[model samples]
Target: MIKDRQLYKLILSILTVIVVAMIGLQLVSSWTQPQAQSQLNLYESDLLLQASTWQETNDAEPGTSPLLENLWGDSDPVQQALKNYQKIKTSATLQSGPTDDPEKRAASEAFVNELDLRLGLLYARSGQVEDAIATWTPLAEAAPSPGNQRAVTAAILQGLWSDPPQLKPQAQQQLESQLKGWFRYQSLSQLYQLQQRQETLTTLRSQEHAAAEKALTRLAAVQVFPAIGGLTGVGILIFWLIQFAVKKRQSLPEAASTAPTIEPIEAQADQTPNTPQELAATVRWPVTTIWQVMVVWFAAFFCVSFVLPVVLYVAGAKPETFGARGQAYLALIQYSLLMGVGFSILYLSLKPFLSQPLKWLPLRWQGSWFSWGLSGYLAALPLVIVISVLNQKLLQNQGGGNPLLEIILNSHDRFSMGLLLFMVAVLAPLFEEILFRGFFLTSLTRYLPMWSAIGLSGLVFAIAHLNLSDILPLTVLGCMLGFVYTRSQNLLASMLLHGLWNSGSFIGLIILGSSVS
Candidate 1:
């Protein structure tokens, strides 16, 4: 960071070019990511399926749950399921034909075919017989060899659901064995109903009833958790209206509490006041030098993010090939390396500029850090929740989200979940706060107004994620993080705030995921 102007400029220029290219690649990667709402739809469909069934012969308290009311909208669970399945049908992939890449074509067609099967069954169950017939008619008539499983399944459905048995008597016998899975289990009760086999239908319906009870119980947990969190957020909002941001008295350094004034950043290095105003209150590192450090920071960021996957790929450790636990563990290692390499380079870059430079960005454990963090957490929840709901509506779940969230949702076992929690709640907060809030926001304050610095750093933090759909919500969350650190002047406070936010997301996703699974 402290070097000859021409030499520094040359290095910075090269880094700038490389970073631009990396950013472009990241943009394409984000934009072109396959839409995975099918996963979410599948989960929600299960909950809705059970809820609709559970409401019958149970004292279901729909009127008592206003929070879940919005989730299901004005429609019954059957209608909501229908709508979810229909949305996926509309956006189903590879409607034209298989893609150029055989593997991609296979994956896309499988996904679309699954959606079609689900939508058709949902239609039949809801008594939209004509719709079901329309949807499955093509599948039943299509060339069986290409999609042998789906074709046979639809043909079987056609035979059972038609006015008279539509199957060639021998054809159903040949194909029925191929329909072996949860898919087959789900269709059994429906098939019994079609056949008017009262005894078998009654037995299968009883099994369904018991399974639906378990599902609704899980839904209750998932529903109750968010409602409680939202209410806590609302309570905090009310308290915040009466008292905003950490009070002036709480913001002052402990050393400055006895005095009305404290030293500013530009104060002379040799003149140490009895009380300090901020970290690095005496060191007068030039704003220009800080800007150089920022460049080095981003250069390392781009290199690690862009190149690490390639390195891992060449090492035969493709992330996508891993299961939940394996992927989570690999992510932990990746994050550790990122902080290790990025910080080492950052420290070396800054060492020449200011002596004991690490002191400038201290994570002091003193003062009301917990309070500040809690306030930020409370404020962040409702605000982010509102934005997220709107974000889904506006984006229609199109812009890709963090791949990590998906991993967290699917991490079923305790060891894997703990690994993810450690990475997200502990490691991520410490590393990211140091880089974004400790260094970047602190540096920006020298050139811009405090609030302006916070906002700009927040925007950068969001953009760093390389996700368009989440940018706005993450930006809002980031600004609250910056605000806490700036007001409290303690890195630990921001870390706490960050950890809580991510932990909350992890918990909520896991709850939804576990229930759905």
Candidate 2:
């Protein structure tokens, strides 16, 4: 037994060392997290353009209300899109750097060239031909060569737009021979169409009016469900407010705390024999050991800090190389493994008392679990949204968000969507609620006030995500989740609430991602 205890200490010490390194990894990786602002900008621009189109079409009628346009204020989506592009241009310029690897250096150069190419198109389309020329000039100055397709294309572009239309004889031939493709929105054929002469914005707008209408139709189609959801939330809030007033604020009161024993065996109170047991098969063991907590932490952080990095390094995988569907599959597998490992560790620590019970956690489905979860979700909407809007402004689209948002947004196929929904809505809620509310908060409640325990657990939950941008809002969200779980005495209630919250976000990202694409 002493030997076993020493071995446990050795394991714990190693985990402590790993935890220190994991903390460092979190801090370093946080800086490189994908920003949410760029995606928001695109979605917002599309929404504005569609709204503007609707306003123009209806304004011709005698009594058309300006309600929609008024709500969004004086925003010109086209200009907003242009400004966003300029910001992107500036950001890409800042990130450009020297590289020692030939492939990396070539990739960097190609990226810059592509950005310039696309930006030049935007400039020309906006009737700034001079700006376009300037944009393409750096690439254009490079000597036309077989390997330098971008330079050759740039030279050809300059020849088409130059005042006197001067060019080497081989320049035109080089573009056709060397360059094959570019961005979907801008390419060689697109430039060629603009070659002979510049078209006025008025003429181009007329040409794109049909496409704009189609985009608007799509935008409106995708937004209908969310509009209904928001309205439903508002209705639910109103009903709850009425109940609060009529019942003197006890309409949805918190449930009585049911914290269990967490003392050492010798210090514990005697229990009745009527307790459920089958030869100690159903013993309720307190998973409150420091070692147990350390193991749980180790499982999570060790995977993130060491396992993930090693796997990616060995596989030579980079974030850019991943598609949404691929990431979804990976997330499903990784989280399944993580949660399985954590629960297994906790279960095994019970040793002689180990046994599978009907209910592993404080999840009671026989009562008002469903209603509690739904109410919590609805009540949470307005407050969470207000904070979220302010959070977005405070962040100014700079702080990183969950990479899953970006991944799920870009995915639409049935299999990938299902995988994502299951992982997020089902898997995440089950594991997180079981760990945080079922174990952590309940254990804390044995010592602290219910509210205090909830608050601390909520804070920890928010920080666990490792997103600075999400910390405040998620803290609020986590508190609501904890409150719901505590009141219902059902882990399922909190899991449902968590699932609904994530499911809502998932839908929104999908709509925005689909519309933008």
Instruction: Give the candidate number with the greatest TM-score.
Output: 1
Candidate 2 global CA lDDT score = 0.63
- Could you tell me which residue pairs clash in candidate 1? none
Over the full model, what C-alpha lDDT does candidate 1 score relative to the true structure?
A: 0.68
Over 1-517, each residue of candidate 2 has an lDDT whose tens digit, in order, gives: 9999789778777876777566556645664433565556556555555445544444366236454444344655445556766776565455445557788667657766866765665566567889889988988886556467777677666665567665545654565454322222233334435454246333434434444455555555445545556567678878867877988865333223333453223212222111111111222454345346645665575665458657876889864676777777777777787887767665565443423322445655578889989888877776677787788667554456786776766667778888988888988999888777766765565545567778888987887777667777888899989878876767788999999999887776776666543
**For model 2, where is the 10-residue window of minimal lDDT?**
272-281
Q: Give TM per candidate.
A: 0.82, 0.70
Q: What are the runs in model 2 whose C-alpha is more than 4 Å off?
A: 1-14, 43-72, 91-129, 139-214, 221-291, 294-297, 304-328, 350-360, 388-399, 405-413
lDDT of 1 by residue, 180-260 (tens): 222343566556565577897677567656666676666666566567776787887677665555463333223222221
TM-score of 2: 0.70
Tell me the deviation in Å of residue 489 in model 1.
2.5
Report how far residue 342 has shifted in candidate 1, in Å: 2.0
